[model samples]
Target chain A: MPIETTDIARLAQILENSGVDTIEIEEPGLTLKLVVDTRPRIAASASPAAATAPAADHFVTAKADVAGHFRAAHPWQDKPFVAPGQRIEAGAMLGLVKIGLLYAPVVAPTAGIVDAVIAENGAMVGYGTPIVRILPHAPSNPLN
Target chain B: MIEILSVTGPASIQDLGRFDQYRFGVGTSGAMDDVALRAGNILLGNDENAAAVEIPMMPFRVRFDRNIAFALTGAAVAAEIAGRAIPPWWRSYARAGDILNIKAMSHGARSYLAVSGGIDVPMVLGSRSTQFRGEFGGLHGRPLRVGDILPCAASTAAIGELGIEPAGITLARPNAAADETIVRVIVAGEYDAFDATAQDLFWSSSWTITPQSNRYGYRLQGPAVKPKEPVEKRSHGIVPGVIQMPPNGQPIIQMRDAQTSGGYPKIATVIGADLWRVGQARLGGKLRFEQTAYSDALAAEDEMSAYLDRLRANMRLVEETRTCR
Candidate 1:
């Protein structure tokens, strides 16, 4: 039997009510994906290349040099080592990775403002896994 | 030197332990987590067996009377110096009058604070450990109290390095989400006396640590293990790691401060290497036991010694790197 339009509408309704961002269903002859439109209007206002150009130029990712579990801060510390928008000096520790019985600190390459934290705390990360994004501090151009 | 500003829970000065004193009816009183004490001392360039403060209960606050380098290890507890957070198991320098506060444990049960030259208390019976039962050793033989003044020996080693990581080591109690901690036991002393079913239950059933557990012993709650017959055993020499079964049938694993002798029948003894696991186990934690061969126990000890050796080498390398920088 062919699928009914009402069935598809009911599945979409279930996905919306469940609060999931996306859901996929596969049948013998049909595959359906329902995704909620969650992007804000401001992001849609800019052209794709123009929107990405600034990020590519200003943001630099701090990656783990060693493979291990990433920690935003020491286990005993309640606050993260660096927070988004916080100004950090060169050589400042941005995060830590615990590889066995040793902790390797991820230090900032240069003085910068933390743009975003990419790796989740306590998540296992491999070598070169981006942990944080930083925007080099330029006195003339402050992040708004 | 350091001064105890306030202590919320039981805290004591401990070294490796008082050895060769068991014959004198004295139990070896030492840091419950000896591995942590050793690690902390190593980080500070002190003797591996140097006396350090073992803070089992938390919210402990103290002030350095003079500049000193210290390391905190073992339990992952929130620690701060003058309101600045410090990493667990890392050694750092503190200025005079800097208040160091250790909050409740976030993971694990005991924490060790080792100064560069160790806590300078009069050694009693060839040891600086606290004998709580006699109340004679370690800072007047009692747990640290508010307003107590603790003397710290002048440190001779240079420890200017910062951000030293404990690196891939964790000694905290296994969290609830993880599988039950498997403690390897060497079946001994009357193990054959238990009925087959009881023996099976002893090995298979998971045990929960009761709230009554302390430095002396961990009272476990699990299926009762009954002997094949009503057997009475005479009181004999007992040491840490002996799992005894009393009338209630629940097993009680003796610990650092356990009595020198007990009348209960001993079913098994936790190997020397894994005792730290039991030491770090918190109340309400779950654990199971697996019968381990004597050869395996010895091998485990060898492995533990190797790990310690590696830690020492790594820390020395860190110190050397700092000096070069």
Candidate 2:
């Protein structure tokens, strides 16, 4: 399913709120990943601005912040994510990966249509590997 | 044109560095004193990443064939123009027949000298940084030597005042200590490879920079932290701040010349913004490991970039102010 792209900082904020540690995507060749809050946590405010301030959202995803090959969710599986017609919800499992010594899990960003699956499953994913495109539902504002 | 003088302690052409070349086995090699490099560039109205001379300790001398505007930053070195005293960390106007000289570093190990316009050197691959092992990039891929002349691009001489204006620069110099020692580190890699006790010793303990310290890495002398598991993984790309421990159990903080890959387990990595502190470490330097969160690292990097921008802006203001005056 297509998942809306969120900046790393925003993803960091999301992870912080959810208290999640590891994010893994395994599509065999497309095994990408990101380990959040790995280093000792420096004291910082959970400011929304800090969450959305990275230069490029694609590269700083919850997966492989460092530069490297883009990977798929599962090498032996059929596809990495839903195609243009697939549907995904917020907090849904996206994929998985086998890093140095751990199995990481990838998840969906929001409820949306799978507009596209950008990367080939099981393909090597680098930092900011884009797996699926999500058409997010517009957020409702009660205050407005 | 820049003239070649005595190749002081260690001077070479440098720029920001190379990136995204990990798969190709390329290491990121660039200016050791990043803040100084930016400051020097701003003083000369040159691009922050423009190639310049990075002097680490010792004194160097050079004769110029023409007039030029240059600035010194990072360490406090006794500099001269044609044997006449000049200020450190500030811009100086040199004449065609003048010679430039640098004395010992009063504080930090590395100092940067940026000329107006910047260094006019051919780019190697994608940078002007010198990679000694590759035997390519920056002035024939070697340290500056006697009788070597470098081409300089023309640039403005002042960017306002150093302290009064905004310049996107971050001074990463270590704090002065009565004893020459300080090692700051953040835990990373396979920390569990070592027993719990070793991990404790690694963080709580202090280490001394061994005499073997050089451009490649710092051989640390301290309590041993051996890994519990025998690591046999293939050697992969490493970075300047990576602390790789061989079976000997001693730690080696890799530097600019570190190998592209290593099989030994990594215990920690120095944060990006603080990498220069590792760069400025001299022989016998003392070090203490401090754990900083990933968020802190990101914030530090972002802040450092901002400082560099401010420093650049300040430099431009200083130059414009000078010209108007």
Candidate 3:
């Protein structure tokens, strides 16, 4: 039997009320799949991977949020995420800290030009250990 | 929901597999790399048996219609969502309207995509795995095509985005060479029928995964493994991992989609614990076999279970870190 437009609306309502994300129904000559929530993209929380470390004026330090072996690049790839003197946009990935088999990303919290990548590649690092120093971009800066 | 934009080769939904139904002539159709599927689900905070997309052909592209977290495992490939790089063996959130594109992998065969809450397909015969030949389970029991939208169940679990080390790399094999993939096997019932030369050649020669290979079976190209005499046998029940010697004399390893019964004589069976390594083995690559004892196979199984246990424990810690934040 074919489902009417009214039946689909009712199904969607029921799925939403049940707090479910999806439902699939099948019958003779008909198949239906309803997804209740499809909008409202989940944005990655503002650079949650790294902690902010204290630094001298005009510069900011990116720190490891988890204790692990800091890797400058993914194991399968050759290029690093960021390098010294590179212009880094806000929310860019700085590197990764591998904890056991899992690797947690290290994201930049603020936009700036990278001054130095302090964390040695493949070296053990503790939580909040300084990893990258960036000269913060400012309205008055000529390089902006 | 995620809609397929472009795809190559055969891509389908798979779970652990539908078992205990072989009497009905149904073969278990599941992820070629079962370990990758299991790990993908574990990484997504879903049940280990949750259904996932098995993409063997690369250059697959899809667009996410909902914001959901997904994990990729198996082959090492360069994948991206909305131009943002996604690492292999990693789980991350995909925003609505984001497109994920995976190019052909440099290594391994199949790649799995397990989303948060798992793929929500109508299950057939106690599984969501696709039976291509029978065409009953999964999405219409065939390969995914362009414009196919896959629905996912609700993501209720609190989990953090992360990547686990590939199990093939973490699990160690004794005296295995880096350039070769060595799979442990046990002598099948018809093994003794083969003469000493053929039996010795089985272990000594390098077997190439031929082009005729598919989900049903892998036709290996190596030394002729003919038995001393023609041992014609009646059709007998068979299972995946059984290595059968056909008339051509090359070994054919039955895979997940193989028929329930076959007429060929069996030489050896790849151990249950080591099948995943063979599953990830690249086509045209060289493979070697080692005959192992039963107890050692059990030990290998235990080691794999231990690695998965560590993954679960560490993933839970990722959630804890979020709560602490």
Query: Over the stretch B208-294, how does candidate 2's per-residue lDDT look in tens digits?
Result: 889887667889999778888777768776778899888888889888777788888999998888777667666776777777888
Residue-level lDDT tens digits of model 3 in B1-325: 8899998988999999989698999999888888889899988889998999999888999998878899999988889878877878989888778899997697788899999889999989899999999998889989999999998886444345578888877895777675578999989999999999999998898999998888999999987889999989999999999999988799999999999999899999999888888888878887899999989889888888888999999888877877797
- TM score of chain A per candidate: 0.61, 0.42, 0.60
**Model 2 chain B: which ten-residue window has the lowest total lDDT?**
B160-169
lDDT of 3: 0.86
lDDT leader: 3
DockQ of each: 0.18, 0.01, 0.49
Off by over 4 Å in 1: A1-80, A87-93, A97-101, A104-113, A116-144, B155-158, B161-179, B323-325
DockQ of 3: 0.49
lDDT, residue B115, candidate 3: 93
Residue pairs whose backbone atoms clash in candidate 3: none
True contacts kept of 2: 0.00
Please tell me how candidate 1 rates in CAPRI terms.
Answer: incorrect
- Judged by DockQ cut-offs, is candidate 3 incorrect, acceptable, medium or high? acceptable
